[model samples]
Target: MQVLMRPWGAMHYRIDGPEDGLPVVFANSLGTDLRLWDAVLPLLPGIRAIRYDKRGHGLSDSGGPVSIADLAEDAAALIEATGGPAVFVGLSIGGMIGQALAARRPELLRALVLSNTAPRMGAPEIWAARIAAVRAGGVASIADAVMERWFAPPFRTTPALHPWRNMLARCDAQGYIAACEAIAAADLTEAAASLRLPALVIAGDQDGSSPPDLVRGTADLIPGADFHVIPGAGHLPCVETPAAWAALLAPFLQDHAR
Candidate 1:
């Protein structure tokens, strides 16, 4: 329930692990809040972790329409709040923000991890169609289809599906639409390819949204970045395979520890 009251608006955030430990910040996917990292957090209790909802998602207040640059600035503000030169881990749109942030404020990040995301999600037409759908029918219009794309077959049948559905259903339509617009406007190929910091790019083999090759292409953009794929997991690997996700992350964090 903690919040960081920025001049633009308040951002909901939570901190775990010790303040003196290696700082690890997490930015979640679109349609999800900080809780997206719940399962993964317990496994990484050794490193200091910070999680936040972007302006629109989770418990944070919305700022009407926004762009990818706006989202990246918000992330920069939060990392600056932490005095972070720490590792930044982001998923989906969160990953897009990380790419934008690294390019915008490279000094704030010691390393980066982009999971189940892309430099650009879909084409302008695709995003426009999605935005039109949400505005017309609300978040419920796309929740089921999004769920299908976000999780693997086994996860779709699990009880976890209930809460995720509820989370999506509860999100503000304007906020969801705003984030979708941001995703649409984002084009980070140049920014991602220019990064000089330690970076790890991860993907779920079964992810329908940002498939492994797409994620790999993003990794390829960063000169020396590492890439890994989690089998049997979809876009949200931290959910379907938390332990495996953590296993892949632990060494990368250590290698890039500040």
Candidate 2:
């Protein structure tokens, strides 16, 4: 575990594996923090894995409104703070941030593995309503709402994933709301064409939040980006189908590692 002081605030992060190995960074989903990668981390070996929370989420100090660029900058800062230019693995808003970073600061990225997110997160009005609800009612109001979109229908019926469902609902509402604003305002369609990084776009077959078609659209925009769909998974593929996600990512990272 590590705490990094950025221009905005102190960002809490976790680092694993030998320092000499290839670096792999993870940018998590909106409501959840670095802890969300627990299942996937063990699957990735021979790499220094990095995971951190966005400002206002998790143990990181809360700050004012944040932009998608701010999220990218924070990611770059984390890289510089811990030996960067890593193969980036991102989910949801994290994927959006990774797109921006890959476009604007290509030098900071070795490769990109994006899950359950798109280049330009369209449908802003829906996100606007979601932000309003989180800000007004706090994260608790959206716990079940997130669960519906985040996991497969069968996972919801399992007792093991229940605690995580409640935890998602209990996430910091302000952080979720602020991150929601970042997603609503971001547009990276033009940037996708310029990306030369080795990239993978993986989507969940049953994910309503970021459906397979949306990920396909993202793949079409980014040059040479590979696309895959995980069976029986939703938005949170790392939790619902960690093994499949790990299998898809391992070779991609191994092929790109310096």
Candidate 3:
């Protein structure tokens, strides 16, 4: 349970593997914490895996107002603190952060992995409606809908689904809304297009939030980005099908390890 005290607030983070191993920084999705990568980390050995609870998530502080750039700055500071020029893997809004980070501080990253996300997630109207719902009834009000988008039908029926639902329900509403505000205002299409680095774009075939075509389109934006789709998975493939996710990620990590 390590914490980095940033100028804004405290950030909860953890580092695994050897001190001198290749650094792989993982930025989690909107509602999930560092534990989002728990199942995927063990599958890829011999590398330092750095994961943190983003502002407004997990044990991190919920500061007032945030944007993709603000989140990217936090990521940059974390990477510098832990030592960087590492491979960065980001999911959902984390992917958006990766886009912003690569554009802002290209030297901080060796490669980029964008998973189940897009440069622009949803329309402002849609985010506004979601914000209204959360304000009206809290995150629990949308937990069921979020779960459906997060997991495939088969996984939804299993008891394993309950914990994830609870995770979403228990998240700070103010933080959740702040993230929604960031997502609403973010449109990284131009930044993603200008990127010139080793990049991999991944999508869960059944991802309702960022569909395969949308994720693939993001891949197309970057020059020479490898794109792949994980079958039978939803928004969070690394969580839903970690082995398959690691199989795709291990080789990328190997190729770019510094």
Candidate 4:
């Protein structure tokens, strides 16, 4: 584990595989940390993988006010720390940050994998309300609310997923609210459209958090972006269906790595 402190965020990351291998940076969703990639990492091969906690989450320090661009700067700083440009793979808030990074730091990205997220996540009022609730009552207040949106009906009721749902409840409230603020203020539709990097957008068929239409709209806005939807799973598709997520992502990364 290596920790890199940048102006905007602190990156606590794990680097694996040979230094010479194509580098791939994995950014986790809001509220969760790099541990979110635990299931997907072993299924992946052929690249140097880097998974990190964003500012305000997990082991990383909660930096100052966070914006989508601020998050992007964190990614850029992480790339510089990793020795140079690398492929960026992100989910939810992480995906929005990826779009911003690719737009502002094109020289630092070889490719992108945007999963379970949107360039411009609509409904700011909803975000604001959620943020306010978390600030007032903590993550426990928002946990069940989030779970309903993250997992589909069947998985929501599954006994196996209960612990995961409880884990969601334990996330830091400040981190959750800050991330929501970042997402609410974000509108990267034009930024994504302007990117020249090869990109892939993976959505979940049953995800209400960042539904298929939201992701499709983002892909439609971005020129020449590849889009795929994971069947049956919801927002955390990578967790629920790791193999399927890897199958969609691995080839895109392989094709784009230079």
TM-score to true structure, per model? 0.97, 0.97, 0.99, 0.95
Write model 4 residue lDDT over 39-144, tens digit each, in one string: 8878777788888888878878777578988888888888898876899998998899999999999999889889988877758998888878887888888778
> Worst ten-residue run, lDDT, model 4?
5-14
When 1 and 4 are scored with lDDT, the better candidate is 1
Worst 10 residues of 1 by lDDT: 1-10
TM-score of candidate 4 on Cα atoms, chains taken together: 0.95
User: Is candidate 2 or 3 superior in TM-score?
Assistant: 3
lDDT of each: 0.89, 0.86, 0.94, 0.84
Clash totals in order: 0, 0, 0, 0
Q: Give the CA lDDT, 0 to 100, for residue 193 in model 4.
A: 84
Candidate 2 to truth, TM? 0.97
What lDDT tens digits, residue by residue, belong to model 2 across residues 1-258?
Answer: 579998778899998889888899989887887878888888988889888888888789776689989889888888888887788889999999889889888998899988999877758999988888877887888788878888888998999677786667767777777888888888888877778889999999989798999988988887798999999999989989999999999999889986
Query: Which runs in model 3 stand beyond 4 Å of their true positions?
Result: none
| Candidate 2 off by > 4 Å | none
Backbone collision tally, model 2: 0
- How high is the lDDT of residue 82 in model 4? 84
